[model samples]
Target chain A: MDQFTLNLIVVGITFALYIGIAIWARAGTTAEFYAAGQGVHPVLNGMATGADWMSAASFISMAGIIALAPAGGYEQSAYLMGWTGGYVLLALLLAPYLRKFGKFTVPEFIGDRFYSGGARLLAVICLIVISVTYVIGQMRGVGVTFSRFLEVSTDTGLYIGAAIVFAYAVLGGMKGITYTQVAQYVVLIIAYTIPAIFISLQLTGAFLPQLGLIGTHTASGVEFLTKLDQVVTELGFRAYTSDSPNMLNMFLFTMSLMIGTAGLPHVIIRFFTVPKVSDARTSAGWALVFIALLYTVAPAVGAMARLNLTTTMWPAAEQGNALDGPAITLAEIDSNPELSWIRTWEKTGLLGMSDLNGDGQIQYFAEPPAVTAANKALAAATAALAAAGPDADRAALLAEVAAATAARDAALAEATIGGVSLAERGWVGNEVTRLDNDMMVLANPEIAALPGWVIALVAAGAVAAALSTAAGLLLAISSAISHDLIKGSINPNISEKGELLAARIAMTFAILVATYLGLNPPGFAAQVVALAFGLAAATIFPALMMGIFSKRINKEGAIAGMLVGLIFTGVYIFLYKGWFFIPGTNMLADIPANYLFGISPLSIGSVGAVLNFAAAFLVSGMTREPPHEVQELVESIRVPRGAGSATGH
Target chain B: MADKSSANAYWAANLRTIGISLVVWFLCSFGLGIILRPALRGIHVGGADLGFWFAQNGSIYVFIVLIFVYAWRMNRLDLEHGVEE
Candidate 1:
């Protein structure tokens, strides 16, 4: 069959299966819809969490950032450090306690714990900001991945993704999503692994899969990773694994991601689905194992694709080449449709081309000024110094010449070449951003020339990834609206059926809102994703952790902490990102310029989280402690075995 | 008070194990990745600095081992404290 037909058939079948699971496991009661009735098996819940945790960004964008950056940037590790570290805080502080509290939702926990309606409302606002920004980012990623891979426009792909999520999420509820997410994890892991296996065999000639990456290359005796590092570095990018940003920024960014991950409403809610506290502990371990299978292989895929693309471009060099490849030659890229992403993106102006010598072949060498007056003056100075003695600074002459040569060479070289050009490298360090990071995982099969089904599996994995996370967020939003707003605060007398209907309506509204954001995405979808972590870091994490650990923390303190946390981090990010993440309108122009003590806004969330904790602690310390009964409850949550049953609220 | 001592022992043991595990966790992602990356530059793995391995893949591998240790050590700690279900 043709590639398109095969992709359709494979992707369609996967969609049908997801919808089938949703219908089979559909929620009947409000509890079932919200928390899957808290009866999920720990191991199964682990798999579901993996699906919930690995979004379109994880499945589509992360490896791309790794591949594209080769050099780690300030915000790039947001995927690695943030996503993984969040679990530590989750398992240690949040999960067992929240599960012990037996609350229906995070806001409900705030309401009961703080004994103030204002605390609950503050939580809702924080949830709306964090979850909406995060969910919208996920939606945009889903749309972009779907459009590119599924052979449909982004609008069609988004609608298709939304419909699929609705069919399962609205129908199956959490129970359905939980069971289906396990299957989705299986589908996605297999889809991701297969291409890696083929590409590994094609490149390394070792078939064992995992060993192919680090093992010596079959074609040449060189290590695969070593060759890849050398190839991209010669092209003027940082080495794959060894790239570093400012230490303070890196430290804070990782912490922000971890805090954000731990704080994310959708991911945390997944833990509530499991049966017992002890099971919750075991389940977390299992989720990591399931996720690690991909995380371990992802870096390998990234390094290997870098090598593979270099070899393809520089075919004459055979093994890995030091020379400029076909990708640099304007004639080769423009004439070849297969390599047209280079041209398509070049027109976006993020990638540009220049012919210094009017040569049709674009040279991509380091173009330090072939010579400079400084070089001449320095040469005269060096000649004098050398004549004077051995006093000449050889290092200075070399560096100056190299610097001058690099500038001229860079100017002489094509302003842009293909296969992720030199300039498209970092996170907010440059003037414009590149979407190459998002394309990393999605473009894997095509880059490797794998089979149609393999490519479609990537497409399917992207959809499964995007759809599952979207459904989870919709569930969180609708739950807050129906349970917290309608039942708890606004009505106080909502019927079960009425609440369920409202939940479904609220879900529809949430999906519509998400879809609008996806279609005409708020100007800074990428920047917003980072801020989602920041906002979560600043607000929910402090409240939840404080509530469980400290009896002195009161409703007023929690509300005050969340509001101050939101405003502090929000204003800092807006001032730097722009009043509202619009690019040119940024109040602060320099990335390092605006960062406090050289801490990037992307990493500022960690500082905000700390501030949140301090504000809550100080404010609570000054006020009254929880009632005696609440203190006993806090003590009870500290242990594992004496956990109470899930409350209906 | 006697019951509280055993309870304290159990909790303390669990806390100790997590404390040590978190130490390793922090060292791998933070210590190696950021603070001590420069110091460890001379130690090469594959073709990159040792710190690079820690940042990209080593920390995650260590994290896997850390969780499993917590599980094993906690299971034993449970027996000592009489807290195991």
Candidate 2:
């Protein structure tokens, strides 16, 4: 069978399975709609949380970023560490206490704990903003996966994804979503692991991808890291195993991601579906174990994918010529059976090529001027310093030039002709300049020449990851609007049936908004989503932490702190990301050199969090203490006994 | 007065456990992974350095272990404080 037909069958079966689970676990009551009747077993909730937490970005885009090391370095591993590490904060500090509080929604807890309607409303606003921003990325993820694997336009793909999420979420609510997510987690992990294991065995003769990552390549017998370090340096990129250029930024970025992970409302709400505080803690651990299964193997997958891509394009020639193999001519791309994957991916336009100098052959290499100029300059500088006296500055310059020369020589050796300089030769510029980072995982199986069903399984896995996250975010948004906004603030007398209807309506509206954003994504949409992290870190995490940890904080203090955090982080992000993300309206440059205290806008969330803690403490010191009953309530949540049941209304 | 004192004592014990665990968490991720990364690079594991291992995989493993320890120890602490669910 053809690849297209196989992809359709696999993706179709997965969708049918999701819909079947949704129908079987259809929610009837308001309680079931909101918190799955608060009866989810710890392990089941952990599996559901795993699906919820590993969004399209984690499953699809992260490994690509790690492999590509875009903008030069492996610093993007902060995302891996920060995201996973944040769960520790959630599991240990936040989850049990919030579960003990027995609230239906995150905002409801904030409102009740602070004893203020306004605080509840503010939390609702924050939750809506975070979830909505997050869902846009998921929608885009669904669109990308569908367009590539199923051969549809991005918009049609998004609509298809939106419809699937709506059917399951609107009918079954949290109950249906919980079960579907479990199936999704299983599907995604298998899809992710199978390709990785296959690729690992192919590259290194190791069964486990994790071991393969650090083992010797079977063909070259070179340590995987050593081989990769040679390849990337030859291509003018940093080594795969090198340290981040800026340690401080890596440290802060990881911290921001960790706390931001804890603060995200969709993830926190998953714990509320479990029965007890103890279950909340256990579930968090299980979720990590599930998440780690992917996390540990990702680095291996990334390295192996990078190596495979390099070997395919610039294969190690049979005659031991390391520099250039017989180039794959344009005509051969269409005719060569082994080269069919290239033609297939090229149709999606993510993988593109053009003969720059009208040469029939494709030359995927570092730009000539960039490689030679740095090499010549460093060589001249080193010679000059060596001629001078042995001063401290000269010694430092010597060391720097030594590394640069070594890297340049590796490139030169690869591009060497029989005494002919690469510049003197006429060759096309790097033919593949548009390698989108998100394409790495999707294209891995095809690149490695895996069977069609494995590729099909990858397609299903991408869809599952996107759909599971989209459902969780939609649930969070709907709960906020129906439970926090309409019932808690606008209409306290709303009946259970009325609230359920409102929840479904809110979900429909949220899906539409997310689809619209996915279709017409703004230029700064990526940066703006980072702002969502900043807002979550600044507002929700601090407010939730203070509510539990401090008895002195009053309603006025909580409201004041959240407002300050919300506005401060929001305005700072808007200033650089364009006013409200409007194109061509940014007041300051978004680069690190332009940031306050050398913190990039992406890492500014951690700074916003510190400001939040400081502002809350100051505000609470000046305000009245919480009422005696509220203080006792804090005490009760602190201990694990007498936990109230999580109710729907 | 005695009941209030005991409750404070239980909270303190809980805080101590949290503090100690958090310290280990910080050491593994931020300390060993980032700040102390270069220092740990001299130590090799398999084909990679310790810092890269910590950043990519070790910290995640530590995080999972830490949560289970916190859960198991906290549950025992709850029972001892007469607050078991």
Q: Report the lDDT tens digits of candidate 1 across residue range A503-549.
A: 88988877777777666554333444667888999999999888876
Model 2, range A238-320, lDDT digits (tens) per residue? 67887787777777778878888889998888787678889888988999999989888888888888878877766762122
The chain A TM-scores for the candidates, taken one by one, are 0.83, 0.88
Question: Per-residue lDDT of B17-60 in model 2, one digit per residue for the tens?
Answer: 99999999999999888888788777986667888878888888
Instruction: Give the Cα error of residue A70 in candidate 1, in Å.
Output: 7.4
How does residue B6 of candidate 1 score in lDDT?
78
DockQ-derived CAPRI band for the predicted complex in model 1? acceptable
Off by over 4 Å in 2: A71-73, A171-175, A317-327, A366-422, A520-531, A582-585
Q: In candidate 2, residue B23 scores what lDDT?
A: 98
Worst 10 residues of 2 chain A by lDDT: A521-530
Which number leads on lDDT?
A: 2
Lowest lDDT sum, 10 consecutive residues, model 1 chain A, at A425-434
Which RMSD values do the candidates have, in order?
9.3, 8.8
